[model samples]
Target: MASLWSKISAVLPLNEERFPLQFGDRVESSVVEMLKRSRRQLYSDSPSASRTLNAQVILDISWERLNTGTWRHVDKEWRRVYSYGCLFKVAALCRENPSEDEILQAVRTCDMSFLMGAAIMENILQDVVQILQSEIRKSAKDEDDSEHAEVKRIKIASPHVPVIKDQLAVPRIKCPSLESFNTNYLLPLKPVILEGIIDHWPALNKHSWSIEYLRTVAGCRTVPVEVGSRYTDEDWSQTLLTVNEFIDRYILCKDGGKCPGYLAQHQLFDQIPELKEDIRLPDYCCLGEGDEDDITVNAWFGPGGTVSPLHQDPQQNFLAQVVGSKYIRLYSPEDSDKLYPHQSPLLHNTSQVEVENPDAERFPEFAEAPYLECLLRPGDVLFIPVRHWHYVRSLELSFSVSFWWS
Candidate 1:
């Protein structure tokens, strides 16, 4: 326990004299005073001093913003405050001899990747997971009288059929040179499946992902989950969950015919660098108009029956299937009228007519839309041109990575 506390103390910034934060510029005077009041009352000479500066106060402000529906548009300075608050609070909680459950809860409650502290959180999580995993293994071995205990494994697969009949299957091509791919597919603004690419990714080969391996590496980390069969439903909502709990509830168990849980369109790489190291970025992303940093990478992991309603993305997308299959149908932007897009501004990019179960009376014209389809499997990368409408459904317990570039 002393050693664990020492490791956590070594990871934090400790006392750098940045206490009593003052965001005077562009910050309201009232908020600035609140920040000052949140400072640590103790001036500890120990290197493992509490880092809980502004944590309590700023967290309240952030929570209020969440309840008021203004979290998305909150000022950047406020986000900076929130990030440090969460970061320091974790250090403070772990300062004492915290058990594994306490440590997990500490990390779970702290929201990460808000703005300024993404890289720091990545490092902190890696350290915490490593320490806890070592301790857990030691405990398990001792429980078995110094013998290895065989862990019972569950076979995970999707019960629902993920296939959909459509007019055309997207063309498949071996990965081409950047210039050749740009001239053929990118120039024509066409969708195609690139095969034999990403075969070298560690996720596909070495350290290949399994349920047990995932639980060991990232089970305790917190992530956003979309809770529903589909995001278009009235009951659809987003909630924060630990990876361990998500796996136990969604992946390890059979689908209960209720809403499915999914981690979709989240920048998980920014929070957990260990998982990020397993996949490589495709070279084709450079053909777009931005530098490497401009590219957007999102992780999509879920059980079967998870559906992404027909929608279009602003940038070109490469959906890389890592673990399981996905049945996909796509339509061009010219057929948006036939697709019956939602009238609301929030859903303007999404279609009102469900691709698989279209309402005949409300969306009679949707039947006329021309579309292409594909069954993306492991090592398969599907390219969707900018503004190309797409509907996706996971075939089984699936983990996919998508990169979008403009």
Candidate 2:
């Protein structure tokens, strides 16, 4: 077992060339401040809808590499070149036959790989800006003015999210549904499709998902994802079966990293011993008070399968793609009206608005939804907040590991 730094150092050579400072400058401080600002703007506490960046732990490497001397040599001569940068790579380092030592090593070190990488990257950008400012100062007055203006534009041109009110105007909220799951439990949880969820468990990978074999399969429901552009019953059945096969093949490959359908380094076998049980199946559990629960999990199979229409999870969630690729279409909570999620908790139906079709005639308000889209490959995790409506489409056969706990 090796610490996160040990694993990182193993992959990337670190020395004076990379870290000339006896103790590298604390670039993490700047990175954290920026992230905090961004997160605050993205999620402000509200009773109706709450969003926050709860996963604060991230891999931090800024202190490991930062110095003008480290990246000084560009040509033959050593020049003072402050090159600060971050690296983001996700992968399951220890899997399958990982020893106790390996697991212990990884566990002992707080899993901050993701956070560290982001911080390091920020440091690099800041370093570049400082270098530019210094160079501009040394230039002639006219040249300095020109360079300053150019640099200012470049800096300003960096991605800046609009104010929350402007972003809220993107999604058209319309035709509220009559029923929904419940306000106490706003999000979806691992409602295992008794059929697809256990499809990849080594013991049940080939097990029968037939209604007769597992009563749960029959009891489970496929909450209507879309209404107008419906999939033929035959097409839907084939998709689920295919999704099972895709997940089996995906985990079998053991390529633990962000691939087409998942996030980086998202391995579950090492964390949850129950998943390895001989009788592979998902057991439903609740995390909140009384009979009401907020989290649920649904299994998928095939290329066309997807999570329910764009809607926020009742609670915060970290959707870890265990197998296959999924395309995510995201909108802020402010755009809820455009997504048109059912307001009732009893019914799991959203507005039947075709995600591919924006017919302003029927759902005119949807035209406003500002969206950010990305694909989740195996081993990648998607962070979703409460009330942040989002849609998912499977690009390939896939299985997901969804964590939703208040």
Q: Pick the candidate with the highest lDDT.
A: 1
Model 1: per-residue Cα lDDT over 1-406, one tens digit each: 5576676556544654644365647566876665544444323433443244455666666555444545566666666556555655565666667677766656564435332233333345446545655554444422242111222323343345545454588988997889988999998999999998899999889867766667666776778888887899999998877787887677655445364889875567766667889998899998888999999899999877789999999999999999878899999999999998889999999999888888999999999999999899899999999999999988777899999999
Candidate 2 segments whose C-alpha is farther than 4 A from its true place: 1-298, 305-307, 342-349
Residue-pair clash count for candidate 1:
0
How close to the true structure is residue 190 of candidate 1, measured as C-alpha lDDT?
95
My TM-score estimates for the predictions, one after another, are 0.85, 0.32
Q: Relative to the unseen true structure, what is the Cα RMSD of model 2?
A: 25.9
CA lDDT scores, all candidates in order:
0.73, 0.36
Error of 2 at 296 (Å): 5.1
